[model samples]
Target: MRPTSLEGLPPTDNTEALEPQRTAPARSVVRGFMYAALGLGMMILFAGLAWSIRGGMEPPSTELETAPQTNVVSAPDPQIVSFKKGRLAYQVHCTRCHGPEGRGDGPDAMALRPPPRDFATRPWSHGETPEAIRAVIRQGIPGTAMTGWSELLSPQELDAVVDYVGTLGPLPSQNTEASDARKALLRRAGFEPVEPTIAASPLTFEGLDGRKQTLDQEQGKAILLIFWGTTCAPCMDELPSLDQVAKEFADAPLAVLPICVDEPDDELVREVARTRTKHLPLFVDRTGLARIQYDVQTLPCAVLIDPEGRQVGRLQGGKDWSSETVQTLLRTITSQATDLK
Candidate 1:
């Protein structure tokens, strides 16, 4: 009975042998490697973006990001002390060619064969006004030694320099020194001077038809002297408006005369005819004596000479003569002619 019951003996105590080995640490190591690779890729992408934008390749910052929100009003125009500051600037910068006091004789004059401009002469190297001088200074004279000073000087400084330079020589009236009687006659003739030695000369020129027309002959009439040249693009540009002005004043005693300083008179004559400027009395300056007298080296210059040969107004650059303001000035002068006498 003991041998037959041997197969159903008591249970064994080896339960630990039936469990699997631990693998959690190895799985964790693999997962950590993947995450490290992912982090490295992300960091590379951010670094690449930063490198691309670090240099001049980056676009300008937005106003909100870079600029302040406050409204920055510009500073007012500078207050000037006197003409000496401008004169000093010219002596330092422009004395090479323009000379001290703009007499065209600087220390560097010996270097330049033609030397510099002699502004004291009747035939001025440039125009009379600051604006005209600025244009020349900024743009420079071609085929000459004069270089543009636009970069060297600020606009205000240029203006100051021009104002100082404009005082280089005697004024328009000084070209023809008048006697005491002539001066008295001018005053009696309703001529007024804005600055000393700056009276407008009496208009006396032989017309195209050889008619000896004087300012006295044009009394009770309005005359406009447009100083221009065929070579001047600005002068050509302003022709249409000038035509309209002449037309508006046709019924009135108004004459628009365009005077050109180009030689070989027929060239300008052809230009006037081609442009169809019938409203204007075209005159060509063969000898260029008027250029010497009027100090009109700059082109497209205009002067408003009243019927009594008094210069009521003048303009140095291109403008619409048919403008309302110009018309008002014309009307005012026309109405005041009677009182001028």
Candidate 2:
């Protein structure tokens, strides 16, 4: 018999007595459910707080416009070099009129009605592209004192200087910053930006060898027009590579015209002549009109024009002309006719 808590209750089995005591587990279960609900509510509150904080945070800023890719020589870590070049080029060719650092305070600045460009402060007067800068160097601003320096500087030097000048004003798309820096280096070196004007439109040139070559007459052949000058160092570096390219495409319709833009300095010209360059046509721009026609501002600027006169590819400065990719591109371009025809 089991002992009973109630006095009148009959004695029961020990197991039956223990059954009432087991109700504690049910109470525990209820308590656990209540605690679980409280934890879930707190968790939801914390999650809402986190979301609010995230919503209050500012979004990231957008990026600026990027500059287009250019067909110009690129140097690594070109900024410092560009700055030095810009400063130097300005002092040499531009200091007389444009003043130091393009502030327009040069000795000759006092004579001009509209003072020379104060490059340090003003926005670019021209469009902000390599081609745009090239255009200004090739064609002078109509009413301004900015005269075209087509003959004054080599094409590579001119591009370098113009690239430098572009950096003075408001920054163009950052992609061009490298090019601008290279230009600065050129500027500091006392160089001017110039464009090559090739008269290849009608292609009439009385070469140094006295052979008359006309652009119109070379209709059936693909023309690899190379504009170069004697003073250009980059052009010198590119000659051997150009020789290789000429040799590789000898049997093809491709024709290499290496035209010298410098004045007839017989001794200097002879020393730098392409004598060993097989199958390359060496020509000279007697009147310097070629620079104007082709808008060639720099030396070692090469363009591959198709049979119909559409430009296929352009290589600026020194390049590995015999590289498989470049050679393949040449082979492909020469094989096809231009859409311009």
Q: Global lDDT of each model?
A: 0.63, 0.63
Error of 1 at 255 (Å): 2.9
- For residues 194-290, what per-residue lDDT tens digits would candidate 2 score against the true structure? 1111112434454555555766666767887888888888877777888888887778777888888774443456567646455566776655556
Clashing pairs in 1: none
The sequence of per-residue lDDT tens digits that candidate 1 reaches over residues 151-241 is: 9888777877777666665455422443343344333433333233322443344445534354456666666778777777788778878
Off by over 4 Å in 2: 1-200, 265-267, 274-276, 337-341
Q: In model 2, where is the ten-residue run with the lowest total lDDT?
A: 191-200
How many clashing residue pairs appear in each of the predictions shown? 0, 35
Report the Cα lDDT for residue 3, model 2: 57
